[model samples]
Target: MVAHSAAKKDTGGGRESGSDAWKNYMRRQTITINYGRELPLAQGVEFKI
Candidate 1:
């Protein structure tokens, strides 16, 4: 999971970054699972605080 906080004047970059991170993470997880691995390279989550 990704966690991010942005100010009212922000341009939503944080959200985009969080989404990208999640997508990459899921892809890695899928590859790992397909290879019969029990843990992903990133076992936890990406936090943008």
Candidate 2:
């Protein structure tokens, strides 16, 4: 759940393509991953279930 807006500034496509034209800030990022408890490969190899 990430939301950020405002973007439309890029003047570069010549002179070796290099320019952001000073992009006036625009960012939005979110990553959430939760995983826990996991142990079971072959409960018969002396792992005893």
Candidate 3:
């Protein structure tokens, strides 16, 4: 997902737009992963780790 987001930033759209798309995608993906803690959304990292 991160790779896809980075690729999109250069090829699909600008940084903010691609990042936002990745965020929305992450939200949806994480919803199903059932992480018990609230998302550490500050940098949109850690949740996946």
* Model 1 ranges off by over 4 Å: 1-13, 37-49
Q: Write the per-residue lDDT of candidate 3 for residues 1-49, one digit (tens) a residue.
A: 6786577757857777777877898898888675544444445565454
* lDDT at residue 34 of model 2 (Cα atoms): 17
Ranking by lDDT: 3, 1, 2
lDDT of each: 0.61, 0.26, 0.69
Arrange candidates by TM-score, descending: 1, 3, 2
Best by lDDT: 3
lDDT of 1: 0.61
Which numbered prediction scores highest in TM-score against the true structure?
1
Residue-level lDDT for 46 in candidate 2: 58
Candidate scoring better on lDDT of 2 and 3 = 3
Model 2 spans > 4 angstroms off: 1-39, 47-49
**Worst 10-residue stretch by lDDT in candidate 3?**
34-43
Window of ten residues with lowest summed lDDT in model 1:
1-10
- For model 1, residues 1-49, the per-residue Cα lDDT tens digits are 3233343125556666667776898999898677555436546865355
Off by over 4 Å in 3: 1-12, 35-49
For residue 24, model 1's alpha carbon misses the true position, in angstroms, by: 0.5
Estimate TM-scores for all models: 0.45, 0.14, 0.43
Query: Per-residue lDDT for 27 in model 2?
Result: 17
